[model samples]
Structure formats: structure tokens, C-alpha cells
Target: SVEELRKLLSDKDAYENYLHSIEEVKQLDTLRNDLRKRNVTLARHNLGKESEMAELRNQCMIIRTTELATAQEKFLDAQRREKEILARSSPASILNKLQEAANAADDESESLHRKLLSGELKVPEFLQKYRQQRVLYHRRTLLRLAA
Candidate 1:
């Protein structure tokens, strides 16, 4: 009787356990696939955001560079006008002094021009320095706009 009862119980328990194992494996496989799909989607979203951010950063730099260039150009124009006034101030009869000052300005301007043309100075920094120098010239001299 004991042996018969043991055989029946074992038969019932084995089949039920095997069925449960099969169901659990199927559920696990489905969960794995779902997680993988979500991971792929998240990765794509993050990459898109990164590229957009990079594009926006580049645009911002371009705008800032353009604004700085504009400010520098205005300052240089003012300086040139002031220099012209200074040149005109020397008595018309004293051409020699005016010529000498003009020559010096030309030499310094040429040196800076060469550096700019050669790409030795970063454009934005060069422009900023030029603006500062122009401001200094304005403050120091009796120069005024010529026209």
C-alpha cells in the first residue's frame, strides 16, 4: 500500500511541476524581449537629443561670434575717424609730422593686418583687443570724428 501511494503522488507532483516550469520560462522570455525593445527605444531617444543639443550649441556660438564682430567693427570705425581728425589737426603747413604719424599708424596696422590674415590670432579675440585699443585711443587723445 505504501509503495502504491508513493507512486501516485510522485506522478501527480512531477507533471504539475513540469507544467509550471514551462509557463515560467515562457513568461521570462517575453519579459526579456520587452526589456530589450524598451532599451533600444530609450537609446534612440537619447541619441536624438544629443544631436539636437550639439546643433543648438553650434548655432549659439555662431551668433555670439557675429555679434562680437559687429561690435568690434563699430569700434574700429570710430577709431579711424578719430585718427583722421588728428591728422587734420596738425597745421596744414606741417605736413612732415602728419606724414610721420601716418606712417607709424600704417606700420602698426599692417603688422596687425598680417597677423589677422595669417590666422595667427583667433578672430573673436583679435576683434575684442582691437575694440579695447580703439577705446583707449579715444580716451587718451584729442581725436574726434573728422566728418
Candidate 2:
């Protein structure tokens, strides 16, 4: 109202204070709106960054799974080759191992006998161990006969 404006104008101090307060409120509102806009922009940028991070993570997992599968295949192939190589060894090698086992059993039997003679082992224990060694020695000899 023009008349109301004139009344406020009659008091210069009141009019000026009221105008200054209104200007301050308008500036504050503008600042709040700008801040809100900036917040929205930052949220959009963060969403884009999150999607990029997820893509990179997926790529890394794909690479890792492929590499692990390749490694597993190589490991299995090496194991198969090792088994084949061992199986291909000559019969002479098998005969030598059987003969060595027989000799070791004979030596263990002799040691047990000596322990029995020296009274270091009980007669029952010596008999059991000596019987076991003799059986092992005969079994190894039978295995070598086939070789």
C-alpha cells in the first residue's frame, strides 16, 4: 500500500532496517539454492564413479578366474606327466628296489637276533620282530622273482 509505504518511510531507521533484513533473507535463500544444486551434482558424479569401480572389479575377477583355471590345468598336466614318467621306468629299477628292500629286512632280522642274544630285547619281542623281518624278506624276494 502506498500509504503504508509512506508510514514506514516516515521512520527512516525502521524502513532501512526492514529493507536490510529483507535483502539479507534473499541472499541467504540464493546461497541455500546454490548449495542444493551443488549437492545434486556431486551425488550424480559419485553414482558414475561407483559404476566404474564395479566394472573394474568385475574385470579383475574375470582375469583372475581365467588365470587360475590355466594354472590348475598346468598343474594337473604336470602331475599326469610325472605319473607317466614314473610308470615308464625300466624293470631293472623295480628289481633293484625289491632287492634293496630284501637286504634291509635281512639286516633288521640280524639286528633283532643280536639284541635278543645280548638280553637287550625280550625273547617274545625278538621272536615277533624276527618273524616279521623274515616274512618281509621272503615277500620282497618273491616280488623280485617276478622282475
- Over 1-147, each residue of candidate 2 has an lDDT whose tens digit, in order, gives 898688688988878777757977779878999999999999999997998999999999999999999999999999999988786576877788889999999999999999999999999999999999999999999989976
Model 1, 87-119: lDDT tens digits are: 767665245554455555555555666788899
The window of 10 residues in a row where model 2 has the poorest summed lDDT is 85-94
Question: What's the lDDT for all of these models?
Answer: 0.71, 0.91
For lDDT, the strongest prediction is 2
Candidate 1 Cα RMSD (Å) = 22.2
TM-score of 2: 0.42
In order of appearance, the predictions have TM-scores of 0.32, 0.42
lDDT of 1 at 93: 26
Tell me, by TM-score, which candidate is best: 2
Where in model 2 is the C-alpha error above 4 Å? 1-88
